[model samples]
Target: MTSSVPVLMYHYISRWKNPIAVSPELFEEHCAAMARNGWRGIGLDDAENFFIQGKPLPDKSILITFDDGFLDNYVYAYPILEKYGHKGTIFAVTGKIEPAAAPRNTLKQVWNNECSADALPRVDQPYVKHELGFDERQDPFLNWEEARLMEKSGVMRVSCHSAWHKSVFISPEYDGFYQPEKRTRTFDRIDSDIIWGLPRFKALPRLANRAFIPSQRLLAAIRELVPQETDAAYAFFAEEANLERLKTLVQGFSKDELGSYEDSMSLQGALRQELSQAKTTIEEELGRPERSLCWPWGAFSPDALSIGKDLGFRCFFTTEMGPNPAGCASRIHRFKAKDKPASWMMMRLQIYSRPWLAKLYSSIRL
Candidate 1:
């Protein structure tokens, strides 16, 4: 039996000049390194058994995972994995897939809102930019054909990552009921973090502006509702009771920004249905149900987790980085690789192999 192995998670593997993008050349080199080292790339099930059943994988086994179904994984990572006869798992964001080639603007324009410097409290901008976005329909983020082709290749295994990558807090008004402070603070924290955390903070005024500008209409609604309460206390109470139903929503989004509480829940339900349909399709192709899943952006809450579990998935992946010791949960830890060309992976792999360093990193980060 082989010992536990490192499960590597990736998002985009491309030749972009952005620091976040892992160049094709470097990606190939990393795979080549793994091959030379006699690493046997395994699937999620292999790790599950090793950790849960006390089964050992062949020595040098590694599990490779790609998150969000980026097109770069297909355009860039797929050929390399095939070249090395390596196997990997792709956590598909099912909502991103389209029947035909989607317009380039849809991909890029959706994620394009540069976050505000003083980030506002609203749903994290649901957009992706094309020069900045990976075309899910056209390129690497696999369309139906590419996904089926990859699944048939024997080296690639596909799984789910929710329909829209909705965060754990995505549903209406749930956060205020449980984590109001954390939820409220997200508006400011996201603003400051994105601006200050990035290399060029000053150039990102759009991020601040994008967030702080509240819709003028919601303010008016709030004002009108408050005044009429005294004049028609009974009628106001009736309306206020209905409005209270939107407290969580109002905390998250203005009534004008979002039509009503029911609308929000409807969108969330639609997303869950999309995920269920994608999982069913992927399973049909595999001739077996996909019992595992990965959260998009590693964003999930009890509601999201329940949805995944109810959908019949056995395990889900996360971004908590480190070696998952035997007996560790399947909702495992994975680190982000920023510094690389192999040095970054190698260092972290070494750290994960060392209990002390793993403990140190967790403690410091926590």
Candidate 2:
């Protein structure tokens, strides 16, 4: 029987209690358990060969991946992996990674006795808070220097997540109003400068949605209608009656003033530009060919997949849960790493590594 590999996906290794965040302490526990149980972490090259060419991988072989390339990965996850002799890949948003003057503190320094564990950077600090508006928020991503350091260490590899990791307005249908309290995704089509109180439209991740661009006149008219005071704007949008009024106003706009969706060709070109830029930027910066891509929010279209292949992405990771057997590179399945104990995680790894068990489990759960 051909052996299957389990790809475990993670986002933030932080103290933050979110769906995507696993605490650093628990992450170390997971790594320690993997090493203790004789499981070896494999890289993308090995994964590609095993999945694409039916090449055999070592017993108990697994692929570990982190999405978004958060600074917390360097601060917490990297040292733990190094300690456990495991390899992982970070699918980074190329646009978020900026150049840094020098490398920031990481758990490596504490592990080497150069600094106390308490002195290491924390994810909850003001500078790294993601809740703040984009311009007001300090970058929470791994800088180029940090990424390079990790790549040079042989324990981590950087791949493409996307250029912007943004979502675009898919329809002009107003869903709500954009308030800081309601902002979930890090990037969006709306301008950052126009913070708070913009019309929230139906949106999907950039690669997944054909962008709906409103005419300048329509946008200007809407902005003119918005209350200038922040509290008033929030109160105005909060009323269901106001929403109906806004909808009526929007409905009054001519077809030309409302907006237009990106044509098929235009969407393809945009996808190409966004993805190619990421591929090229990562290659140029890291000095290696980036052949792996993890779609942002695990949202991608047929056009996205086709464009990704043309740009040389060989392995495409999705959020779907399943066992990855030989010859499944285009639709690689991954199970999310949750905030759980090492034993719990290892049990999942066991199930995912076996095709039959994984199928049965997924079926029963679904």
**Best by the TM-score measure:** 2
Cα displacement (Å) at residue 207, model 2: 1.2
TM-score of each: 0.61, 0.87
Instruction: List the global CA lDDT of all models.
Output: 0.55, 0.81
Lowest summed lDDT window (length 10), candidate 2: 126-135
Candidate 1: where are CA atoms >4 Å away? 1-3, 100-140, 167-275, 354-356
Pairs clashing in candidate 2? 51-327
- Evaluate model 2: give its lDDT: 0.81
Residues 225-250, candidate 2: write the lDDT tens digits.
76756666666767888767767777
Number of backbone collisions per candidate: 22, 1
Which residue segments of model 2 deviate by more than 4 Å?
A: 125-139, 179-184, 187-197, 223-251, 254-257
